[model samples]
Target: MPEPEKSVRRQEEVLRSVNPVLRGWAAYFRYGASKRTFSYLGWYGWWRLLLWIRYRHPHLAWKQLRRRYYGADRITEGGVVLYNPAKMRVQRYTFRGAQISTPYNIDEVDPDGARFRRTNHDDVAFVGQVSEYLA
Candidate 1:
């Protein structure tokens, strides 16, 4: 989606334009249940790139395009690596449960008063409980 007119550019140039956006998207969504979404994004990116390559080299076959762009385990062209969203590791936030300190019970939770105050303590506790139960 980032490089709308990359059909005239080289593979490395297109990758340079697209990788940053892909990296940012993956980073923003990594801290949630986003594995499936990441996989779909990766597949969609691959398909779009392949289509671009086909447009660029209409005379070449799919095998030639694959050999030119894809490496053994990753997509690489002109020494530039293509960012794959599926490679991003999903990290779900851990629920501290009762260990989490709230503004009302900050003194009880942390005797040393090192923790910050949480304004919406009830909402935070409910979400944490639900996440913990689901996990």
Candidate 2:
């Protein structure tokens, strides 16, 4: 059985350090009666936290301090939030596409291990270094 009240307050501190909206979103997404529990509200809060982190605390994207302490990716810049997996969550997974960015890889393998490549891609080029923004 899990220990009672060992949940710690460090996450609350980190959440407090962030913006109000991000903090609220993280609380709504990452905290619950059960870790496995999730709903549309939780997912929405998750997305908001990520954007918040990406825009505010980009440093966390690499070695996420909040994630390390809380074992959750409940916050991010510009408020795009996500539930960082820990414990049993490793057995469950979900994938989401990004709107502001897309994979740049020109080649990838299919689920069957067949190689496939991208072609006739748009000539439209975004003119800034994506890394710098995150940095």
Candidate 3:
């Protein structure tokens, strides 16, 4: 596998670890796939699983998904940020030119990881970072 593909797969894995319920729903709904595609499930058991997650862990639902930004000033180009999107916002930190907005009433903020899983999410559009950019 190429380097870019590896990063993409890694991103999917990170997302799954942070939000398994949403990932499973996406997999069943034929949406989130790194290499292979999935189709809708017709089984009652699968529907039951979805319902279980929905009622038990309502925060992980698709509609309630929130994007949490983290600061990674030391991360390299290909690094990826992974965090639970359903977490509440606290302090804010800037990373690699991305601005993280914060609340106004708080003082002495640390901008720690929302759920202890945040990382740097770098943006690279080239197939080969150096080769494509230099060409």
Candidate 4:
């Protein structure tokens, strides 16, 4: 592959790693030489996986699929930030420019991952608010 082509492929790999399911399914749809056209399969696969990614995707950069909450400073250009309250630490780590998988907050004051996953589910808490911007 040319240098640019290699770069694009590497970028795709990074993206797919962040969002394993959508990218995995999209890779399945593509065939032969057409698989190189990652863009085409990407669009369709995201639709299938957006809800999963938004509400419940795990592992920002870690590919083990371990259960946890993940996010990016920006959906477009930031690295993944893994949040795990059980561990009693909110780590702002970097996972490159993969798709953003922000975690939802359950408590108004104590926003934590496992707590958010359990005792609360306010869709509005996660969207269309100043908090989302701050997050």
Candidate 5:
């Protein structure tokens, strides 16, 4: 909740600070059964912003504040757009049945494991010496 005493701050500043957090939260919950949750959160955020506006301008009537801040059912103030989570589409993950294959389920013949074995003893000894020095 924003402090009414801090009403000195501009509406754009508040929106800019809050938009990123709302965007990230909405994105994280978008790929699941979260439509209801998103809608609830959107309503909650809208109500809170309305309360903040009321606190900031106690002299103004509700109609004036609504006209100034809200348009076409969207909240827009000082050219800053409020991120509404309800607008996010929920996409359920579909099972890709039998489309994925694991190493154990592969039917191909295994190739030779030591196809690139080191043939030079000198090179092998140099690597061993380097490893020992590092250890």
Candidate 6:
């Protein structure tokens, strides 16, 4: 119960920080029960805003979308956005096909030779320096 509340609060904070319009829409949509009987204008408007953002602001929308791929071959210059910090890992790949040669964490593997940088945010980490090991 508390976890869901925390998640909602975090989402509200991010949305408010990014755009106050979204915060207002979220508030109205969540509490517009009285207005829901006549028309779902608030609900419809929120979905439209989300779709608009998805197409017009892909980079910003990426935070809402998620993808998972194993190994270094899939690693991009943008690096990996680890939503779950518990899965922090260093990936080493072969130069030929860019396939992973090894996958390890700080505890299991020494990062001296990996050449990576980990940037932590509220609940996610943007790991850069992928080319060093993938090269």
* Prediction 6 TM-score vs. true: 0.20
Candidate 1 TM-score, C-alpha based: 0.66
lDDT of 3 by residue, 29-106 (tens): 442232222122222323433454455456674554222211221111235323222221223333522133345412
After best superposition, candidate 3 residue 112: deviation in angstroms? Answer: 89
- Kindly indicate the candidate among 3 and 6 with the higher TM-score: 6
Model 5 residue pairs with clashes: none
lDDT, residue 41, model 1:
89
Better candidate by TM-score, 2 or 4: 2
Worst 10 residues of 2 by lDDT: 84-93
Stronger candidate by lDDT (4 vs 6): 4
TM-score of each: 0.66, 0.22, 0.16, 0.19, 0.64, 0.20
Model 4 residue pairs with clashes:
none
Compared with the true structure, what per-residue lDDT tens digits does model 1 show for residues 43-94?
8888788888888779999888888766423666777787888999999999
Which ranking of candidates, highest lDDT first? 1, 5, 2, 4, 6, 3
**1 or 2, which is superior by lDDT?**
1
lDDT of 5 at 124: 75
By TM-score, the better pick of 1 and 5 is 1
Winning model by TM-score: 1
Candidate 6 residue spans exceeding 4 A from truth: 1-34, 60-135
Better of 4 and 5 by TM-score: 5
Give the lowest summed-lDDT range of ten residues in model 4. 81-90
Cα-based lDDT for every prediction? 0.79, 0.42, 0.35, 0.38, 0.75, 0.37
Error (Å) of candidate 5 at residue 42 is: 0.8
Report clash pairs, candidate 3.
Answer: 80-120, 81-120, 81-121
lDDT of 6 by residue, 1-135 (tens): 455453333333433343445334444444333334213443443444455445654675454432322322221224322122112232333353212224334344344444542334532323234445566
- Superposed on all Cα atoms, model 5 deviates from the true structure by an RMSD in Å of 10.2
Model 5, position 23: C-alpha lDDT score:
84
